[model samples]
Target: MSLAPRVVIVHRTTEYEELVARHGTHGQAAFFLGSRGRDIEEVAERHRRTRQALAEVSAAVPLTWRQARVERADLDRFLFAPEDVVAVVGQDGLVANVAKYLAGQPVLGFDTDPGRNPGVLVRHRPGAAPALFPSVHARNTGADELTMVEAVADDTQRLVALNEIYLGAVGHQTARYRLGLEGDGGVVEAQASSGVLVGTGTGATGWLRSVWQERGSALRLPHPSEERLLWFVREAWPSPATGTSLVGGELAGPAGLRLTVESERLTVFGDGMDTDAVELTWGQTVRVGVCGERLRLVG
Candidate 1:
């Protein structure tokens, strides 16, 4: 007989009871967002009646409680479990780590946009392509560690991205970057500009397009360039734009095109996470993509 799948329902500490009652997508489920002294009683009262039902479903309970980002070792233990399904129920924020845990497994994540409140669904698949970003690194994860980057990349699957992969100067002046397209045989000129926006189709109208839409004045981009998600730094906005251009002054230091080949040090960020201090002189390259793999967020 085939054993039933176990689902690890990770959420804010408060939602434990309700999620367990619904038995979301599996017989066994774990909640990995608990606090040490968190008042479960307080959560029960505010969330809903499901907590009360959770008390009754103790028999079907495969409940695994979690401590939120308490430590690297702790997260490794909770996520690397050999469970059948790891249903990460939350915004797109925590999906990356969850992806790290259930590498090469049937992964799902709940996503939220400007219109959609946070919801849950599948985020990855065993054979599905990885998302459009540089590979995930298992950093500082103790001495003996195996990162998922290699395992996931081995699978031949396209990735899905929900927004823009952006990098802005953090502590110093805004830097500059040279742009060159990857696929075509010809090399394009290195346009002098501040940043880049490499995103997926879903991300197009949102984060990627905002710089144009908010400014209400996009540069006269050609048809092919606009269709593709890759963009270069051409315009500058000193203040926080509704969507168009970098809010230059608000971001790094005096924003006179932070991205530059001369300075040669770029703070490379992907999916809103700052990762490396890039050396531009060597043209150090990092692979980032807004991959194609979004799922239906069932209510």
Candidate 2:
């Protein structure tokens, strides 16, 4: 006899639920929102709809499969097995949040409200879980293999970013760092900038696009499924000890970027989760490159 395949549904607390949890009651939450010129009823309705969608998905799971539900906040601590299929029940960002932790498992992203959250990642409707499960179980589903960016520090501590990786001062202020890139040979430069951004093809439209807009470059960005990555040094200052020549470029094939922390403290975080970050002191080196694992997202 074989064990039943497990389905893990990932979700987050709705706005109304969070407000009530913090305020200890609906009355207090309403009062707080009313003072801010926000209507509590709107939030409450959204919460109601989100719960209804989740309930529908729960009811649609196959009867023979084992099931579990996880909140977004608790994903860092939750243990996932090799045979688990992840069902993300939230906006697109939630899919990125969960992508870094997965290796080859198939992910089904369900947008609770398609009207408000128009997403590229979360394409399926909540009620589509039952129809989506069989293909995922057989591993022949239509999916996109999204590349990821990785930052390895001291060769041990590392972070895999599904969207992009940020490296800079702990406060994101202008800081000092020795930046190096591996090309045909090798190039190293010192820079005084706000920070550095390394993003994957899937992230080109997000923060990477903003950075590209500032440069006004004519170069085309990578597509969402490409095996390439982009790097940009934000606001590189031309000073006596630093230069701005190697500010932006593409990293492909065997090329990568290295940063030596010249400031008192530097932090490296992935997918905009600042809480789950690695801190580096002066003289520490961190390498940013393509990750070995990829995100298998079912459409």
Candidate 3:
């Protein structure tokens, strides 16, 4: 017989937990915070709410179904099965954090603190999981197939993200690369700047929005469900050796952006997770485009 479908619950370490870990005890953490004119109760309250939501979601899993729980730090090591249903119990960012690891499995996002979170991805409450479980398991529930972005190096090293992928220097130093748009008679430019950012419509509201707002309507951002990707070369510096004409544009249909590494080394990371990034050496090339995988988020 086939195994029961698994429900994977995902969460992150709370601020309270981090504080305690850093200070060695709750009392010490509280004292450290109090010394800086902050209150520990606020952090503790958030921790309590997150814990309660996790417990409630765990209890809501059907008795006959298999279940698993994982923290954000451990996601890189966790293997997800094809027949799994993911329950993200935290904020909307947590949902994004887990998106790159999944492959079309239904993701039900639960907002532990609705008042604090934006409720974009994690729109449901813990109490709603019980009523939604049956429909989700049957694959009859409504879902949004959010578009995602991907970057693949010449060596076949790849990275994916729900929000955005950044290719830049390992530190704060300027990055050097040759940027090109792949298509008929595409243009290429040798540039020195902060870095490059490629993002999806689902990310239009986050980091990409900040860059868009500053550029003032040069390009239109795509919708969350749209199969489109946007690219921007951050703070492109112009000089005799470097041109800035090919700075930003959109990738629709089969169009893609390519980057040839000119610096000693560059780092590529997705969704702001720099620790887990792909490193590129000089003369190496990487391509950024819309990923074939989509995030099937349960609403």
Candidate 4:
């Protein structure tokens, strides 16, 4: 069996050398710098004191050692090959994950925030790979949002995403989309507000929070449920008479759609990513997995 690859990081506040001395340093590594502890010994000593206080009854053990610190974009540019395993001590999105891999950790991850959105599938593949290779994918959100990209040959990679694809408003018009949801008998069609949040446990945090804060949306990103949360709303002018308010909770679906403000455009926003509105018409609907996948996380 192959010995699993290891890379230790004394992140944000953890002591690097202390980890080394207490855990021993045979197969492990270290990379940390703190102002309080100017040298490695100081850091290690503090860790010893802290540990003694915490594990009053037990003894501290040494750890496996193999560590380094490399933080540059040019140097950090690589993907996770199936044969590698990396350990990390930080938090970041996909881009950050890629950077860590380049930093040398194969299987890298921090704690998971159930409140944020999950891993999303890139609508377009990012780069070119060799003809054949092996890869993996993880769902950042719910059970259905599983996405994996495996190599077909020596250097090729194929990706699969579980969540839905999104199109943000650019500037011309609203990014209108006819939302399609899974129904008991078949599929249900409806008009979405600015954007549709097809999410899992992970998605509820970011986009859902903005929705609640911005529009005061009637819905909360309910915890990851068996059923996907769907929001349908259309942009329209607030009528002085009895129409919905275009300010707060104004963008709503059938239950609140008072009238269709036949303006020049309509569009949706995703994760507050859009600056100028993206032009969308009544005829387009994007397809995305939206469901989440299971990903093992290390503390």
Candidate 5:
């Protein structure tokens, strides 16, 4: 007989929990929020709802299957098995947070609070887990293969994300690097700017959208299921030493955009998680492109 699949339920610590931890007590947390003209009950209610939803999802796991619970902060340390089914019980961003860590596991996104969340990735409610879990385990469910972005450094450091990847300096200062696009002739430009951002269709609805809006209709962004990637150089500074000719473009097929670090130190982070970024030194090259591993999202 085949081994039973493990159900990994993922969630993040809510604002109320964070506040209480920081303040050392619920009353202190309430007082802190009150001073800011905010109500602690609002945060507590959301937290309560999220916890309740998590409990419901957990209870829906099959009796024969192994179960695991992981917090967002512990995802980096979690070991996901090949036969594991991931159930994310949080907001849409939580789904993105957990995507990079997964290989090709089917993910079921659960929205604890409906109206508050956009329900883009987390489309289902907690109650749906009872029916959805069996379908997902049997591989009889419909799933969307969402594209993801990846960044690989010369040193073999690799990072993948569902939304986008950011490469820039470690501090507030401008990042200096040489940019080149594969298959776009031998042309390359040295640039000084805020940094570089490469994203997928899923990312277009997030940070990539802001950059697209700023440039009007310069390039068409891809959809969530499109097998393409978009890249943009933020605030490309033109000076005697650097050129701004290579600002932005699309990456398709086997092509990738390359950035060679010229600054003392640079960082590559994905999905807005700056603390877990890869560090790069001068003379190091990092390539950004569409990732081969797609997020198998079960609707």
Candidate 6:
């Protein structure tokens, strides 16, 4: 007989904890809130709700299965086995953070505040967790398979993104790179722009959408589950050495988008998190493509 699936709850730090960590003490946090015309009680209440929800979620897990709790900060170091049924007890972004580490495992997203924070990814509440196990365990759970983007630099550092990947200067300065877009026939263009954004259909409504809105493209944006990817070179400038024609397009199939670093320094980060990024020096090449792994999100 097969063993029970282990329930792994991934949670992030609460608002109160963040305030205390930033201010060094609860008293200091209160003072800072007061000075900003904010009530410390609000933060306290938010933290209270978060903790209560987490407690309820923990209690809801059935005793038949093994359970493990992982904080968001420790996700990178956590080992997720194939049999693990991952549950995220935080905001929507937390689901994205945990998605990259997973290898086709079923993810349950529980929002701490479902009223104020209605999430697309984290659609379920803590109260629903207990009832979800049977279906999840039987592998009969309804799920959305969200496409993810991957960025590989010099075949050394590789990072997967559920939303979008930003490739540019660390500070959003002008980024210089040889932009290569793969189509029926490969086309490479030397260009200077703010940066490049390679996003999945899951990210169409996010960063990619904003970029498209600003530029007003006639092409249709990708749907959440689409295997295709969209690339946009922000503010591509016209120079003697740089071409602006191939600023944006769709990338699919084996040959994806490639970037040869021409700037003194450039960094590739995913999901708008810069701290976790790959810094590329001049002449380094980074490839952005669709990640084979898909996020099996149980709504």
Question: For each candidate, C-alpha RMSD in Å?
Answer: 14.1, 1.3, 0.8, 14.5, 0.9, 1.7
Task: Please give the TM-score that candidate 3 achieves against the real structure.
Answer: 0.98
Look at candidate 5 and give me any clashing residue pairs.
none
Model 2 alpha-carbon miss at residue 192, Å: 1.4
Tens-place lDDT per residue, model 5, 107-136, is 999999999998999989999999999999
CA deviation > 4 Å runs, candidate 5: none
* Candidate 1 runs further than 4 Å off: 1-4, 12-84, 96-104, 107-162, 183-185, 215-262, 275-282, 287-299
Give the alpha carbon lDDT tens digit for every residue of 1-299 in model 1. Answer: 54444444443333544555665622332332233445444444444432332222222223342212222224445644443433443345444434433434343443222123332222332122122111221111111111111101112322223344454344545544433333424333333345555543334434555765655544442221123343445353333321333332111111112222424555544344343223234344444432223322211
- lDDT of candidate 4 over 75-183, digit per residue (tens): 2233444434333222333322232122222333422222232423111111111110012212232212222111111112111211212233445344333333322
lDDT of 2: 0.87
Per-residue CA lDDT of model 2 for 1-299, tens digit only, reads: 88999999999989999999999999999999999999999999889888988998888888999999999888889988888999998888889898878878889988888888867888989878878887789887888888998999984888998889999888778879999886636678899999999998888878888888888967578887777888998989998889998888888856789899998999998888998888999999998988878998997
Q: How far out, in Å, is residue 36 in model 5?
A: 0.8
Q: What TM-score do all the candidates reach, one by one? A: 0.44, 0.96, 0.98, 0.38, 0.98, 0.94
Model 4's lDDT to the true fold? 0.31
By lDDT, the better pick of 1 and 6 is 6
Residue 294 of model 6 has an lDDT of 93
For model 3, how does the per-residue alpha-carbon lDDT over 1-299 read when each residue is reduced to its tens digit? 99988999999999999999999999999999999999999999999999999999999999999999999999999999999999999989888899999999999999999888899999899999998888998978999999999999999999999999999999869999998989848677899999999989989989998988887757889999888988888899999999989878899967889999999999999998898899999999999999999999998
